[model samples]
Target chain A: MTDTSATSAAAQAPSGVVDLLGLLAYAELVSFFRLSDAAGLAPDLAAKGELAGVAATEYRHYRMLHERLAAMGADPEAAMAPFVEPLDAWHGRTEPRTWLESLVKTYVGDGIAGDFYRTVAEHADAETAEAVRGAVSETERAEAVAVRVRTAVQEDPKLAGPLSLWARRLVGEALSQAQLVAAARPELAALVARGATGGDSGEGGSGGKGDLAAVSRLFAGLTEAHSARLEAMGLSG
Target chain B: MTDTSATSAAAQAPSGVVDLLGLLAYAELVSFFRLSDAAGLAPDLAAKGELAGVAATEYRHYRMLHERLAAMGADPEAAMAPFVEPLDAWHGRTEPRTWLESLVKTYVGDGIAGDFYRTVAEHADAETAEAVRGAVSETERAEAVAVRVRTAVQEDPKLAGPLSLWARRLVGEALSQAQLVAAARPELAALVARGATGGDSGEGGSGGKGDLAAVSRLFAGLTEAHSARLEAMGLSG
Candidate 1:
């Protein structure tokens, strides 16, 4: 009976994995569109080009996820279909209207998301962990843009208040939607919980931290990193 | 003295080729952004995915042009810089507001431009001609989108009038900006002239027709093609 249950669980794991990958894939797709559109909001050509380069990197990430999903025997389009509306609605509601707003969103939103992925990656299976790690690595470019924005804001302190407020709103919106996603997918939540317990040998739970504790650590690290970045740019920590 | 002059001109030709390649490179970059943005206007997830796939193919073209430009000892960015303002201006002035308008712009604008490149390729030297041919050949995806749009319009005759008007405007705007580019770069104009005149016999330019006559033939063929496409879609020719 235990063996049969284990076999059934193993069979079910792929569907959960497919759903997770599909969600991430669509997120990257939508991110590409948003970043590309945001490129037009840049104040100058070099900034535009840099943001476009970031956008291009997202396309590469999209392609990798797409190939992996196909290899896993799921049509990427079909896998991505379920989350499109909610994701689109979130982005539509949070569209940034200025260059600074866009940068802040990239910085705050992507930074925390990267950290969450890192936590999840610790408990995922080998292939799943690898995919998440690969995607998270691309966040560095967006981080660099954040650094640039911090430096620019330091040079003009009057811009600081507005950008900081924008960053706060971005995080709030992201957290809101993330909770929605988590609520909607119980299997994913359970997978995340297992990873958090440090009991799963897979990437998600391999970090030796409880779920809430792991999340707390992630937020702490992100906050410290952002503070250091801001200080390095001669801004308030 | 003759040898010195010939060597200088030969060296200069590569720079000209780089300019041509760079123009195509930036075109691919912008086209990727535009097509991806336009995909958001798509009514269905499948249509959106299809448009995104088309956008991704443009990056493949960009990589090819970037590699060729690097081989020719030219900085692709610098070569592309001169054309950016004109191209940006053209797109900014003719932003598509509707799904049908976006499709019409893609079909008419890209189709006509591809035709022009075909003519230019015939007049280019061996390597350059091959590059142009390779770049133009990547239009298969865009052509597929055009066919889909035409069928969609045929199914709904109400789409015919607005889309036809949009197509005309797209062509008109494209021609106006192309003339601006032609007037601004006399060397590029000279290259077009020389190529059209069949001056590089090393590439075997003609069986019977002169360069100008060949160019005229190309234009006629392109016009007829677009007319047939439009007519098939139940739009005004």
Candidate 2:
């Protein structure tokens, strides 16, 4: 009794939301690979073990995101395919060359991504929002890495300048990628717009095409936190 | 009052065991790294996850060995120093270049090492023997890798020749290294000989020094297992 065309259309539903999920899933996968690889650079067994522990946590996150994508009627691999090239390229371009660089990468990159997810989760539906909440909460491990870096930098003033510069580049490239994703996916942009401008408030705002305010708030919070961390490490923000 | 010479000698009493324990501890650490790195070559997430699980198990072994070494009145770092260069050289020389090569390395190298440990464990005192027993039993995960490789090789006849050659080379190199260790430390070699020969049967056999019988038995069992695995994979022994 159902129209064949309608069934096909349903099956081929626009997967903009799925694309966002895919992005997050691939991010976790690449993070796992990078952290696991970087663990080799640790100077001692204890530090190596700690880094390996962090790598294991990243794999756990990948599994969770992968399952969520599968539950939403998308092939996790196919959904993940489009984003892999860009994500890989980004990591390739910014591969950390030293122990401090590795820690800074985790602190700045993961910190901003976690903040962005927290804001996005607030605007998402319950299930997806809860997933984002879980992901952001897991950033505690990354915070531990940041604390280690902070302690190390404080003990040696010479480390501060290079690490601060590394942190800046990490944040800059991450923001550039965020802009690319926003421009590439209209549905994702629409989702952000809806989340940012909830209710029909046609007040001073132009047609609520996107939520620049929400975006700015997320970036500002992340930048402030990072700057505070740099200052604590005796580095200029 | 204690003589200064006697006190200094007592302070250095466990130095010899430190080298042996350190080698074992770092072996486990490097195994964890190599296995996890090689896990990337798996064709699917499920397979990759399984490999990661095994690699994590290696970390547990590394922790145990490390703790034991620390408890034995030795600085684990100092203990592990001497073997670092040699083991690192071995790994560098035998780095697997492809996925199949990695699997073969895991199968052949781990299989022989497990057999060697089983033989060595038989000679160790109660506590050391128990620890070795625990480590040997952890080989089940590595065995799974072998079984998977065997099945894959069976499915593709063309894979048989190269893999067989690879397995032979792996075992050959492993045995070469074992001989190197045997020749490097005569006292440790004597300890292994006593363990292998069991109670003062000290018939001391022909050498009146090291027992070749025990070494032969260990090598024979390893060879049998290795041949059976190669046969199972449809490759010549």
Candidate 3:
């Protein structure tokens, strides 16, 4: 279900590449802000310092993505603008309430997003893909978040139910916003489409399962990875 | 005023150095959190990116200061614990309501702090002092904050009156907190007293102006610099 205009545009230009870069850059920028805020939510000074350190890396990643967009002659803000509202809405709706919620968000929610982006990066140019990989690299703070979550749930078995529900909600909210973004940005949709019908085979290949089927496959892959992450965290999807 | 205990301690130990480093390290950590929060208050994505970038530098500075403390066999969290309340109170009492107010806080509030710390750093051990200097160095985002404040005030002359009052409040709140921190940490007070009496001339000499008078003089110098900074931003102190 490629939009006719998006198909036309995808045929002639690489707006999808620009859209993808823009989305990634904006995501990094937002993560920088949110992760730093999460530092304040940390229960201890050591945790705060660790989260703050993690937040800094997000900014570095944002700079790299912005630079890549600019080198390609795109106004970074303009490129990123399209995804802003959806992302903001997702964050606004999914505000973490407690320190544990914040940790879970970082470990489970961000883990899923990181995986999705890594998959998308596979379809990008070499440099873009490398930047994506670097940006999504989980630091020790993330590992710490995972450790803390596992310990907390193990100590309080009752917490697993609430946290598991929270994790599911996070995934639901994330996927909803992702759909919103894809619906609004056909160029990005086309990029996913192109990536789906075999990499570099161009958008809407002759016998490909069309955009909707390809997008379904992409979501299925995302869901499978997300379930694996939840199970690792001792939570059911 | 030198407490009898602080004077005796200062004569035998470098607790003053630890206090100074601790204050600075904690300051960087809090700034990392708040500056990143400020990025959310930015009016545009570009400004958001810039503020977020500024926030990242604070974490790097925090790491350097934390490393210095760790190298000195100090527990970073415990060393930082003492000043946390005063700093948190200061931030709580002077929370910025608007984007412009947030900018003013960073430009005016943090400017005064950076200057005061630089002056205090001069009294510390060379390595600690060097680390202090490195942590407080302003990046372009700070400059951009200054420029934005100046331009906003210039564009709306009416804004100056309220902003000027806000600047005064920020300084007052900051000074009040500084007084609180100084009163609680006698070792830090002793460092100021020694620095005031002229560095490396021993703790107490016949030519010294005693602790109270010397502290008054130090505040005077800090006040003068603060006033000059406000004037540079076109705000009356």
Task: Tell me, by lDDT, which candidate is best.
Answer: 3
Q: For residues A1-237, what per-residue lDDT tens digits would candidate 2 score against the true structure?
A: 234443443244332556666777777776766676676578776677667666666666677767666655567777677776677677877888888888777776676556546544764446667877777888755667767787888799799888888778876776566666655655554444434344322223322444454345334555676786566445666
Off by over 4 Å in 1: A1-11, A14-16, A43-46, A70-82, A97-101, A116-125, A141-143, A150-162, A190-237, B1-11, B14-19, B63-78, B116-133, B157-162, B190-225, B228-236
lDDT by candidate, in order shown: 0.62, 0.63, 0.70
Q: Give the least accurate 10-residue stretch of model 1 chain B, judged by summed lDDT.
A: B201-210
iRMSD for each candidate structure, in the order shown: 2.5, 2.7, 1.2
* Candidate 3 deviant stretches above 4 angstroms: A1-15, A139-141, A193-202, A205-209, B1-13, B139-141, B193-202, B205-211
Q: Name the candidate, 1 or 3, with the larger TM-score value.
A: 3
Clashing pairs in 2: none
Backbone clashes in model 3, listed as residue pairs: none
Worst 10 residues of 1 chain A by lDDT: A1-10
- lDDT of each residue in B140-168, candidate 2, tens digit only: 45767767777888788788888888778
Candidate that beats the other on TM-score, 2 or 3, i.e. the better one: 3
| Model 3 CA lDDT for position A161 | 92
Supply the global lDDT for candidate 2: 0.63
TM-scores for all predictions: 0.74, 0.74, 0.86
| Candidate 2, true inter-chain contacts retained | 0.04
Docking class of 2: incorrect
